[model samples]
Target: MLSTESGEVNCITMFKSCLRYPFHLKVLWLVILLGCDSNLPHTNEEDQKGQTALVPQHKFAGTKTCVSCHTKEYQDWQGSHHDKAMQVADSRTILADFDSAKFLSNGVLSIFYQKDNKYFVQTTGRDGQPHEYQIIYTFGIHPLQQYIVAFPKGAYQCLQTAWDTEKKKWFDLQPDLDIAPNEWLHWTGNAMKWNTACADCHSTDLRKNFDVGSETYHTTFEEINVGCESCHGPADKHVTFYETNAKGTPPPLYMHNNMRPKELVQKCARCHSRRAQTTSFFDYKGHFLDHYDPSLIITPTYEPDGQILDEDYVYGSFVQSKMYQNGITCRDCHNVHSLKLKKTGNALCLNCHEPGYNTPSHHFHKINTEASQCINCHMTGKLYMGNDFRRDHSFRVPRPDQSVEYGTPNACNGCHKDKTPNWAADVIVSHFGETREDHFSDHLLAGYHENLERLHELISNKTYPEIARATAMYYYASRISPAEVKKIEKFLNDPDVLVKNETIRAFSQLGLGNYLPQIKPLLEDPVRLIRLSALEYVNKYEPNTQRTSIYQAAEQEYMTFMDMSADHTSGQQRKAQYLEAKGDVTGAIRAYRKAIEIDNHYNQARMNLALLLYKEGNTSEAEALYLKVIEQEPHVSYPHYMLGLLYHETGKNEKAIEYLRQACSRTPAILRAHYNYALILQQNKQYDKSIKAINEALLTFVDNEELLYIRLVAELNSKQLQEAYNTCLLLVELAPANPNYQQTLQEIKRNLESN
Candidate 1:
């Protein structure tokens, strides 16, 4: 039976499926019929087995509650960007011209007009039919502004076309992205839904309240827009404490008022960061991880040297800054109420830095020029959402040398668009002497190349930033050597919480059961994030029977965290993996199913579910799912490779070869697929084809010992004596000390001499 959340979502999904047919009456009738028992509580069995339901912990008191006492702050906040973040579409709020304005994008003519004092947009709807949708809300204030349209099944989708607030013209938010009518990434699709993607951070005390079973949202918010209470947390308790005082003595220690610099930054990060929401809403009292999973300095979102590439929204980039490590927080330079710089332009930097830094002699440019600004060189900006230029917050010295070596962007080259990185590097050397060799990017780039020795040096260097060290350890987690684990263990008690948390995660990835004793104590660590990581590692070990109580306690906390995040795709996947490890097959299946229900295009969930089904003797279902994933992601090599493996396991050699060949033919072809296909070809006496496939694989993994060994075998079998000798020579270079490679090379050389 489906869980309560799943069942509700299914009902709404079914209703929504019929919405395109001009069947509003029929959909309403179905909703009415389903409501007969929709509100009833779940059965005892469901109560026992179902995941924990989220209950909101705080109540919003609104901006008005604080306005009387905080008059000056309220005045400042009234006209700020946050105050205008969201609003009801009306004369004052609507910024776009709605008097029959026409905008053309991607061969579609979108018309914006007013009918009977209400805003309406004539655009392509979810059904790929041109229909007029009433615009209900204005999404944002500056640079660009979007409108939200309320659709059937409680859907609120943001229009793909937005008004360029600065340019005062309509523009497509995704100019290059051409979305198909039926695709999920379309403006009419699930991904563009406001409640899931943009609602949480835009409003105060937002409860997405998405019912997974019905595939519908009953989203609620205490305030319609980001309010005073959004960052300050609920003010009810503080107000009560003040009112009860009667004498008007200074309010006792109130909510989040005594937060440290780190705590304040984390509170800001709850909304500002590129992070995944673990809990429905942050309470401001817990660790950042207690409510969310902040994105690491990984690819796509950031450059390899930790510069912003996408709209990371500051938190991830700021964390990598020396300023953060040296106790600087967001509020230091920004006014918390006004959300503006305390001092405009270079004056902000001059507050901490010497006044000499503002001079031409120090900057090597005119004093008042844009190039002389501290942020122009140190922070550098990227233009996103068409014209919105945001500055990077990593606060690193411009390293043109790194840009030359690793193809990372430097402020020098960023400003000097016509100049090459090499030119910029040369200019830096001439201006400030030779470039420093001690840079995190050098180590990070080395880690990318899988140089474990260089990574070890970074991880062990006490002077290095914890974020750099932590990221180095993350890279090492995949290609870890046995000796490296001992060194990693030393970081379990690192001073920085990020280092400790990352070390625990690396340990969990290692799955080293021998360190169970060392890991168990961390299960009760003070920090929620560290304790959770420790719990995952402890569960992997599953420890002795004597430690059952200790294990159970930590497991409960870990499970609570997972269940709270079940509203998210990652949460369900994590829960499924944990349940599968604990031998709860049924529970794991439910979790995986829930994840797929939340996001049908979740490739990892589909792959994992298929693998699980295959293990449980459901081969047909697994094959169907594998095919479905391929249909969605035609160019992805992983699904094809796995399907090939599945066919091989089932002794279907013909099918295996077909899928494996497809995998090998894809761009950046799968190495395993090439190797597997070559073996199968050789087994079938297709010797020439086998050598050709192996040669292709060798090009990518030139030093891979197994591929080289297999190539040598294929060459020798095909009676190519010289080629076999060359393969053996490459193998010897790959594994210089391996006696087997030495012997093989000798035999091949002798055979070549005889030939």
Candidate 2:
């Protein structure tokens, strides 16, 4: 799923998806239609935090109720981003060019105009025809504002053309795309749908009442925009306690009353971070991962070095920062109520960063210049959604050296665009010492290259962020050595929620094995994400036991969470995979199809569906599905590898060789591609070519047993008796237990002696 769930995942701060499983770990959610949770591990998010949830039945008193008591905070938030996050589509709120402005993007023309004192936009609708739709609402306020129009089945889509407030013009959020109307990423499609993607973060207490039976949303929210009750617990109890002065538990302290850095960051992370919603809406209770599973430092959202490559709001980046580790919160830089910087430029950084950092001697740049600014050097940003420029908050030191080696971005190249990365690296080395400080990205990049030693080191190292370590472990699950398995198994008891969640997930991939006893305890874990992973492991791998009630309850909770995001292809894909794992092939097939139907661009679903179809004896359709994935992603090796396997199974030897060759030539280095291809050649009596293939492949996969075996057979068939004899000897050494191999070696010896 690592497309960081590679295209297997994705979306926006306002999300989009497919059978895209959020690997870095974020996706859009539908509604979770759960019946009961009596036997479930935990009923509330607060169980993870050791607090009983108090606001489950709490009433919202509205922003008006809080105005009398906290006038300053209320006024500060009046026109703030959160207050203007969402608003009715009136002249006062609508900021786009409505005087019949014509904007063209790659042959698609979008016209913004108004009639009857209402804002309207004429754009390509779902059927690929230009349709005029009245704008129902405006989304967000500052750098860019998107328009929302209601559609059938409770659908609300945000227009692709957004008002570039700073430039005072209309621009397409996604540009230069020849998107078909049926495509998921089209402005009228599910990717741009506000109900599924944008509404959760933009509004207050959003209940995304998506009905799975009808595929509709009856979405409701307590307030129009993010208001007081959104962050601070529903104000009714707070107002009652204050007005009546009847304090028992003291209104369950406001989110920021005496907030720690961690608490403050988590509260804001609901909207700020790229994450998947596990429930209907954000409830002001429990751990962050309980309601949401946040995106980790995964690509294309994040570079391997944990630098921001995509629009990864703040939470994901901040959590990886040394500042966060050292206890820096959002409030330290910006006011909680106003959402404005407390200090400007270098001064804000100087509050914590040494004064020495501000001088040219330290920065090696002119004073008061953009290059000299702390943010430019450290918080290099990317321009996203056409014009919205958000900076990376990871606060990492510029590593030009790593950039030169890894092709990752660095602060030097961000400004010195004309200069090569090598030049930047040399310049950095000349200024700083030759030795760069050790960072997790180096190990992460190495791990991608099958560097097992670095991966093991990174996982064991607690100095790096737990998210990075967990991500490393996620990759390590497949490559893990038996000796190192116990080392990783120890992390199942890790206190860090992410590390433990990933550890359980890793072991689940490896199977329960001897760790079943250790893993069974995590079924009752405090964190929901952790418990879910643990439950998945025990439920799948463990033998029938007396804990049927406990198992079923956890299973139901898992299903309910899976059901929540069933609207998106990613959600359906996840459910499909889980069903497939549990031995429900028919159900899994249905779910996979549903996922593909959600988004045709969901190649993960296509690949999985194709695989299932082949297994189910529906070879023709499976072949077509494989072709469809190849059509969508011509360059990717996975679909090609699967197609090759299908051809091999069906005895289409020529086509099998063709695709296996393609698989071997691709970047992923399909593990058995060379062996499979050579086997087919040998089977087809192309002994010389089979020997040639194995000889070339052996340069890289020097000791691959299957490759060696196939080469031995090809050599024996072609009458290269001495070569075959040597190959058999190597095979015998590689696998002595195989009597077939033992007998074959003796036969080859006799043949060699005769020759």
Q: Give the number of the best model, judged by TM-score.
A: 2
**Worst lDDT 10-window in candidate 1:** 26-35
Candidate lDDT scores, in order, read 0.71, 0.75
lDDT of 2 by residue, 207-293 (tens): 776788898777777778878878886767767887898947666744856778887788788878888877655667676887788
Worst-scoring 10-residue span by lDDT in model 2: 1-10
lDDT of 1 by residue, 255-299 (tens): 345667776787788778887664544544456666565666666
| Model 1 TM-score, 2 decimals | 0.79
Off by over 4 Å in 2: 1-51, 54-56, 247-249, 478-487, 508-517, 538-547, 678-755
lDDT of 1: 0.71
| Total backbone collisions, model 1 | 11
* Cα-based RMSD of candidate 2: 7.0
